[model samples]
Target: MLDRLDKEFAFGREALDVRAYRQELLSSNIANADTPGYKARDVEFSSALAGALKQNGTASNSSTLKMAQPVSLSTSSSLAVTSQGHMSGTSTLAASGGSTDDYGKLAYRVPSQPSLDGNTVDLDAERVQFADNALHFEAGMTVLSSQIKSMLSAITSNS
Candidate 1:
């Protein structure tokens, strides 16, 4: 019975998680619209949801939805910086202040209209996406609520 409940809620739960994360990304893009050289980032929603669901199904403790793990270079054959001007391969990741898990899944958005300052965020598009994702998140929550209500009613009626 517990397993049955888990299976029933898994899809909606995973979807909501993805939608919530996407909302955060869109909000960040909107917030950074004025920052020069700021590239807007987003996930491919359908694919991300699919991957999350797949991982959830295979792993027993897969309650959390996560992106792909970031790749790292082995120290054995890593690049050497002989000159002081050289930057390490991992420096960009560190400078971005984002974990490899997050950076791996996020893709830069191409600007519809190029900005003079090189920021890729389009406010109009970000707003549209944010609204759409919020709607989907609400829908998922409503469906989950309905499911739980129905289960509760069934359990009470039997008692």
Candidate 2:
């Protein structure tokens, strides 16, 4: 289903989603640059990607283990959400791996020169970052499109 698609195109799909979200966050920051006491917000792409990869790896390993088990194994499964919102699950193989701290997580890149009003939406820096993210997003989308086109060609050629 859609979950399978997400897992299969994990990096490309998730990166696109995160980049889109980051774009929105950055735009909001820029829009509120003149607003007092507004702190700029951005997505921590590295940690998010790492979390997604860990989840996908766990799911793959669990599925493989299930295939090896007997039909009547009757194992119980449970999913636990950590404070940082990462999903952990227990299965027949072993317990969930490890927990992460939200406070000690990656910090956002602060503006080089903060404003008197405490707004940190450096227009120049934000413009550069927006361009870079857009390029990456387009690249990921192009790769995904090529993959789908190839799959379609394969299916049609066999007919």
Instruction: Give the top-scoring candidate (lDDT).
Output: 1
lDDT of 1 by residue, 1-159 (tens): 665677677677667777877888999999999999999999988877766666555235445333323444343334678899987653322212113242237789989999999999999999999999999999999999999999899989956
**Per-residue error at 34 for model 2, in Å?**
1.0
Mark the 10 consecutive residues where model 1 has the least summed lDDT. Answer: 91-100
In the range 1-159, model 2's lDDT, one tens digit per residue, is: 544544455556555655666676678777887898777777676666555445445334332111111223324877767678775655453212122221124345587998898887788888888888788879989998987788679769956
Model 2 / residue 125 / CA error / Å = 0.4
lDDT values, one for every candidate: 0.74, 0.61
What TM-scores do the predictions have?
0.70, 0.63
Total colliding residue pairs, candidate 2: 0
Runs of candidate 2 with Cα error greater than 4 angstroms are: 1-6, 56-106
Clashing pairs for predicted structure model 2, backbone only:
none
lDDT score for residue 132 of model 2 = 84
Candidate 1 accuracy as TM-score: 0.70
